[model samples]
Target: MKFAVDPWDPTYGTSLGTELGESAAQVALDVELPSSEWQPIDPDPWVVPPDAVLFVDGVRRVDAQVWVDDGGAEAAPALCASYAAGVVCCCKDGAHLLTADVRRGLFTTADAADDVRTTAGTYRATRTAPHPDVAPAQLLSLALQRELADTELAAAAAARGGHDSVHGGADDLLVIDGPLRGRQHLPRAIGFVKSHRSDYLPPQLGGVVAALRTGQRTPVFRLGSSWERHTWYLRLPCRPGAPWAGVVRVECSADLSAGEAVGHAARSQATLPRFASTEYKDSRAPQNLYPIAGLERELRRRLGEPNLLYRALRRAAAA
Candidate 1:
């Protein structure tokens, strides 16, 4: 599964007209999937072949988790920072106890020279924040929104002549981390995906509907505020019947998420495209900022386990 997007596509939900509070209220009710017809995915998170592909339908980031750690000195924020180590992480689902030795832990990508390295923590830590400026809950929400936005923005920017030709290549799954909603951004994204139903997404969202038609891998999601909360997003294979269309949500919440560590990787073994990343490492610029090419090479090299780059994830996950 591949995602070819259109950066020019009007960014909805960001502008006015709809009150932010009301918009959230509108999404309050869970868009129910006709369970009788749509089959949810297996809650037990599994691994996809390293070569798997993902077509991101759309991403709507509700920065609600920020509130979970609104107070810089809040308990949730501290806990979020501690768990950001990539093990024993918490979310809305409960707890996801990750074992560094068992899971990929983090993903590193270095530039050609391997001078500057960037390691995006693979497991729970990727979503945690230890600084007072960014509380854990707030950062987690932002991470979800930003990562998905990177994929969407990248595909859109990479499209050619109004047609997105990116991830059309046949692969296993195209994972877009989020939930499903009919209206708002979710519905609009689905519309685009259905239009591009060919190898990649059709003019609109052909790829999205196709994923629904052909059962997609149950997308693994972490509960933003609490790692303990585990929600599974599975597009029923062929959608079983009409009306109960593409994308199904499976609630696999538990008292703790410690055991399901191995299944929490962002992208396993597949070719990782360049993502507009968070301000994880880049704090100052010019005087202190790393060069663009240098950053890329270092980022890739450090994160690329096959090479010798700074192993931030290994250290963090173990912490």
Candidate 2:
């Protein structure tokens, strides 16, 4: 037997986890092609990419974990997180940042908790009610993510509206760097998932994903979780290694027809590979496209220094 290393840096975790569990989402594999005909589809060289490609990403940092002094017998645990979202637009002229927004929040279920105003930044109090199904920390994290998602949507809208003057009336493609759960309503938008945690496809179709070569993609399929979306798998350019190296899942809103989803899938083949990052430049290369990497760095910078923010929070608490 032969073993191959996954190109993703170990610190970030493997691109594909070993504990592949079946997805709870209802999956329809025949949206674009019959299961019997499943195989990697080569990119259509003739399909021209959109005139402009917008890359949207968000970064969040937990500045500190604190205990809320609510009037209850015991204090409630809360998290102070700083999150920022941004968009980078790539067109015939060049790639440049379009919009970026930063937000800070105190997430807790304590009814008495108020907005946190520190010297560094003000974290608006976000009430995240406890869920029996989820942990408190995870609930706080999810609340932070929801704020980030909203910021991302705003950034995307601002970018699109602000750039039309510079890029003319040319068509654009919106690429969200993670799952498209909340942002699926955006037009011409596709979710760019860099890694996999669940096995959404059956073993027969999973073989198709493993067999994909650079610049190739699997046929579009539908995934229904809490929300529904059409998705496909594409292999980005990367050094030969793991069977799933450079693989990423691309998805679009289920509101689109199957043919339209297929069109987006084909257009992705012509578009995304151009921005694929090399291992030398990115720890999550290929999957983490260049524009997205730069946007993430910028967003994190906008989030401010974590240590400074933490100290500010501590000082505020002391006062």
Candidate 3:
């Protein structure tokens, strides 16, 4: 028997799981190369790294769960959530936070729900009609996630607007810390997925991903279903471990030509490994790049103290 220890801390869960469900989306393996020709592609040494790399991420917390009384037969359930999004730009001058936006929201389905104000902060009421497919709590959580995504978009835009002022005539690449679902319209942006939940490729193709060496990537493939995007897997620099250790999935808008997607794949291989974190520094090292880890800390800090916020909510409810 043979086995390998996953470098990622167990508390955070393994980077890749053995039980992966098949993805619902349709995958086209021929986008960059036919399935028969699948293999690891090394980084293009000629592919120049962007002058600046913008790392975007968001953090959210459920401060408290509350009930909203709106004169209805039954009280409506609501959640008080604090979420924040931000961007950090890395360039010749070094990494600096470019933009950060913190927001609080009372997510509920109650029509009479209004903005919640507390000494700690205000959670503007965000009403979403209940859906049969989702539970109330899950719906509220989804609403909070959507708000965070929107904030991330705005923060990225703000960062791009001001980026040139700091580094004149510099080309920049935008790396969003999650799926590019709603934000695919952004130019020069790619989603950096740190973990795997679904098996998007067949065993033969998956072997290619596992075979990828540090700073190498699989051929680009198109995933289509509810959404469409070009995606590939890359391995970050890390000690030898599990077959799938140090792997990360990168995605770009499907609007790009296959050649363009391949170019982005090359660029990612050439660039992202430089920011890979070490096990001693991060529980989710390698896949969770250094800038993103730092940005997450800053964003969580901006969310304020959860205990104090919860106390304030309690007081507001009593009043």
Give the TM-score of each candidate. Answer: 0.23, 0.96, 0.97
Ten consecutive residues with minimal summed lDDT in candidate 2? 161-170
Candidate with the greatest TM-score versus the true structure: 3
When 1 and 2 are scored with TM-score, the better candidate is 2
Compared with the true structure, what per-residue lDDT tens digits does model 3 show for residues 199-277?
A: 9998867889888888889999999989999999999999986889999999999999999999988999878999999
Over 4 Å off, model 3:
none
TM-score of 3: 0.97
Q: Compose the digit string of candidate 2's lDDT tens values, residues 1-319.
A: 8899888988998899888778899999999989999989999978989989999998899889999988989998899998898999898889888888899999998999899999998999998888999988888888888888888889988888887776575699999998998888888999999999999998767889889999999999999989999999999999998889999999999999999999999999999998999999898887989999898888888888888999999999999
- Structural RMSD, model 1: 21.1
* Runs off by more than 4 Å, candidate 2: none
| Tens-place lDDT digits, model 1, residues 195-277 | 11112111232233334433343333333331233333333222133322333333323332433411332222111112112
Runs of candidate 1 with Cα error greater than 4 angstroms are 1-24, 27-54, 57-148, 160-188, 191-303, 311-319
Q: How many clashes (backbone atoms < 3 Å, residues ≥3 apart in a chain or on different chains) does model 1 have?
A: 65
Location of the lowest summed lDDT over 10 successive residues in candidate 1: 78-87
Each prediction's Cα lDDT score?
0.27, 0.91, 0.91
lDDT of candidate 2 vs native?
Answer: 0.91
